[model samples]
Target: MGRKVTVRDKILETAATLFYNQGYVQTGINQIVAEADIAIGSLYKHFKSKNDLLYSYLEQEDIRFFTTVEEKLAQKKTPREKLMAYIDFRIDQQKTGNCTGCHFIKINAEIGRTDDEVQQLVQKHKEKQKNLIKKLVTEIQPSKNNFDAKQLTEMIFTMIEGGVVAATINGNTRSLEDIKKLADKLI
Candidate 1:
């Protein structure tokens, strides 16, 4: 029998978990290959380089993370509920041990805005999320007051990033709860 065709995706999945949990700088291709139980050539076959694998991993995280969220958020009837659902989902995710500060932001810092495909993917993911926050804010409040909407959205996203980092580093889930309260106030 020949090797399974799922090797590439399996490798990418392992790479994403490792790269995000441990900084990209701290993860090496050899480690990914070991964790993935795939040959070195298998990784190289799918991605041209470690950067390419990291780029693909970030994109996958974006798709999986937001798709899961938008799916859950859709179940809520009101935008207000949906917005709160987003915060609640983050807290719930922390409880499940999936917490790692925003993967894009963490990778972006580790990579330091390098002119590489991975960094570009990271920027795109962040911009997409920021835009989503803006959209959700507009939907929830339908504000004629542009300043309030803008400030609230910015503060909420900021608090979210802070909460994620705190949860991952200190295991302090109170930050997530505190941020949700602050988000309610800002909104």
Candidate 2:
């Protein structure tokens, strides 16, 4: 049997979908309350404000994203393979059609700058992602090539992020595929 969904889960789920499909600024608390089938007082009780809900959403997404990525990485034995798995993971996400590119990036573009808390959350997410890549890169066996680990990490991070943005804008995974190919050659 499935676990029962709580009112807070309903609110977050509804808000996440709306915030992803529609802009955060365009989505309102009343809309969330209506869609979530919860009372305004309940939402307020769970989340102090819209910004509070946004933070909660981001935190939830961060956990979900990293957990999935860790599972994906676990399938591969080598650091290089893990890196490729990460790219493949991103590709699969783009193919799913549910992805609004990178949620952190989208949120940042939306109101990250205006909202200091949101901005910090987004920055923290990106830093966590970069650090993951750095960990994998550091695990890679040293090769005869002259590549710097730091530079390689930055390059891979940029390519992956840039590819996601391109794929999102073009509504296709060609950019990600191309990046995967280029990254495979580099690493």
Best by TM-score: 2
Q: What is the alpha-carbon lDDT for the whole of candidate 1?
A: 0.81
Query: Which whole-number lDDT from 0 to 100 does residue 44 have in model 1?
Result: 92
TM-score of 2: 0.95
Cα-based TM-score, every candidate: 0.86, 0.95
Model 2 ranges with Cα > 4 A deviation: 142-144
lDDT of all predictions: 0.81, 0.87
**Candidate 2 lDDT by residue in tens digits, 65-111:** 99999999989999889988998999998889544587888889889
Q: Put down candidate 1 lDDT per residue, 16-113, tens digits, no spaces.
A: 78876888889998999999998999989999998788778887888988998899889999877888888898888787765656777788788875
